[model samples]
Target: MPSAASSEAPSEASTAPWDVHRLPRADGKTFLVTGGNAGIGYFVAEQLAGTGATVVLGSRDADKADAAATSIRSRVPDARVRHIRLDLADLASLKASAEALRSDRLDAVVHNAGVKFDQPDRRETGDGHEAMFGINHLGHFALTHWLAPLLAAAPEGRVVTTGSFAATSERLDLDDLESTRDYRPDRTYGRSKLAQMLFGFELDRRLRTGGSTVRSVVTHPGGALDSLTPPRPPLHAPTTGERLRGLPAGILVQGKEAAAWPAVRAVLDPSVTGGQLWAPRIFGLRGPPGSGPSAVIWRTRRSRPACGRRAAT
Candidate 1:
């Protein structure tokens, strides 16, 4: 429901006329998107609000979160959008937000908060997990778990986790999850994404097996350019990878576009079964939304995201 122009940026491939724009409003559905202030998260919040769904922009930064909600309301004059503070790195804040939400049932939740290799120093959150694992995976894991009861109250709820193709290079090191002894920024970020993907897969498997009606889906926005994403070829190395060699790093897709395609598909696409992975159809994963491959990274023996698979109740 964001302004049609908000997501109108061109993509790496031919752009679609955003049928999402025409979809009817989601009158009764209520959604919460973490990191919903900037980048893809903001776009997701805006679009959902455009559908007339009550959107809660869960954000870590108080100011940014407020600004995002304000912008969404501005874009959609009647949008019933609001903001909530949720520092994923801190469980206390996540819990407080869960308790404060007035809605008893959440129609869907999009876990999109993440950080890449910007900071080289190893970081540990309040919960003591590696900064990447803590914020990107476990923080979300705990938040979702705390809200599962509310989500389950809905007849057909869904959970969407944003992952990245960068995860392909990741392998979880449970023993070194905190990265206390060694710090490799890029690899750590990859590990965080890997955790998210596995958590999605694991969440799906458990949900299906438990016969829970609530659906869980995962998405990987591959090759999309964003602030969190490394520069093409990564400044650390200039001439690597086919996608990185020449593509105008910024031309891949706008954060809004990259997020819109996948977020819309994940929440509204009828065929989007639980556990499905959605990405762009074109080279950048920046085009029309379509199912994409779940990387083999989560399948490897080293993945330690099993903890995320645990069921509530």
Candidate 2:
């Protein structure tokens, strides 16, 4: 167990009142961030801990999660953060992770863990579902179901599912949810993300119908690259092509810290309501976070060019 501590003292060099450096205080709150060991997830945990939230990092790798917690403590000296092993690719692991949550009342959960397909070969989980859909959708489905009770008990609870713009172009095939017959790596990933967004929208509807206070929303960390993210354990130093790609993209893409803003807002901001989609301000890419149309909105609005044609609306 990691030692508990109060929030870190704010910095004196703060620029704007609404800057990521100056979030509204979250003292005494408790939240969980899945895939909290790396990329956007790591920064989300760090930011939440800075505001006085007890952050539980749900990760498949215990050592990596511990390292992330240590890094947060190093940056925010008094930050309260801990790690619990959680493998989202496996259903049994999700159940165990939910059961092991130490907090009696969880204020929020940020579902951020996922695979960025870099290979052409298809993969599947032990349960025989496609790896991307299994981890990104079904795994989270079970985890959220298990934790919904705890969330409902809190005065205000939230579930933030991280989605992608790719979802807008991909249609989910209920008849072939696993993408078994035809699996193109990138398209399958898009389908999985779309499924996640669908789940978020559906969850909000169900919560509203059931008169539950637990809100569900979706967010996308646009153009967040591994090159801009801080190093994690077992670092595979960027390849030559990746380094070349990073140099040009660094100008256009937001760093992991900046990309984390939308997710952070989804988890903590009071103004953000259920079923909203928060995204980056510039080109939905690199800038401060802001509210965007939800997937439900995209489904309904055909006037928008990007959403004019729909295979899965």
Candidate 3:
């Protein structure tokens, strides 16, 4: 968290209406973005790299990660970035992955990696947990646990969790967190994101209780379309027809590049605080980043312990 005095200085400027184009410099910081090889994650990494910070792209695929890093270097000629292999679905690999991070003090970590399925069939991670819940929620939970020391070492370390608008309409079935009983693709995916959001809020509460400076924040990209996104070579290159088709959607939604704003602001903005939710400014769907709704109705206090227990098990 940036100090009140520092955030208020004219030079530091407040993020009342954060401008994605003019971000504050973070030359000495080292930030890691999970699943940063493509989609919204790649844009987040790209935008952050422009700030002169050393950005690490955490991806399960080495080839894609390398491509993303290379692409970033091409765009921001002086960008300092690298890639690390990280498979969120494999719980056993996270410890080694965290240890592999060379930075002694991690300024922030954007938990952006996730898996979404469209089929009705249920899928499980290598650890036998529901794929969505396991990778999106539990995996981040474990990763944060392992990286606690490094985060605490930073002046004001932060944890930014990428949630989804789908979570707003869903509820977590604590008993069937793995969705073994009733497995609907969209609903299951939504519940998993909701779980991740709750975990972020609860983690902040516990961190404050423990007198730790590391802050946890949650953000959601309301509606992002690939067609609306600009090309980035091997990662994403929408056809001209696709771009034309997405023109109408631009009024209600936005591109994956714009979707990355909320998370980028959460990581760079000094005014942002822990336990807060950030999202697109327009109807919580499109536009610049801003403070969004709180998840109080979800009763994170009561449900978070259950989520923690399940993850531990």
Best-performing candidate as measured by TM-score: 3
Q: lDDT by residue for model 2 over 221-281, one digit each (tens)?
A: 8788876665444432456666566777777786788889988988877777887677776
Deviation from native of the Cα of residue 212 in model 2, angstroms: 0.9
Report each candidate's C-alpha RMSD, comma-separated, in the order given: 9.4, 8.9, 6.3
TM-score list, all predictions: 0.80, 0.84, 0.90
- In model 2, residue pairs whose N, Cα or C atoms come closer than 3 Å (at least 3 residues apart or on different chains), thus clashing, are none
Which residue pairs overlap in candidate 3's backbone? none
lDDT at residue 152 of model 1 (Cα atoms) = 94
lDDT of 1 by residue, 88-121 (tens): 8887677788886787899899998887757777
Misplaced by over 4 Å in model 2 are: 1-17, 230-247, 295-313
* Sequence-dependent TM-score of model 3: 0.90
Candidate 1 vs candidate 2, lDDT winner: 2
Kindly provide the TM-score of model 2 when superposed on the true structure, using C-alpha atoms: 0.84
Worst 10 residues of 3 by lDDT: 1-10
**Candidate 3 residue lDDT tens string, 112-144:** 999899987899988999999999999999999
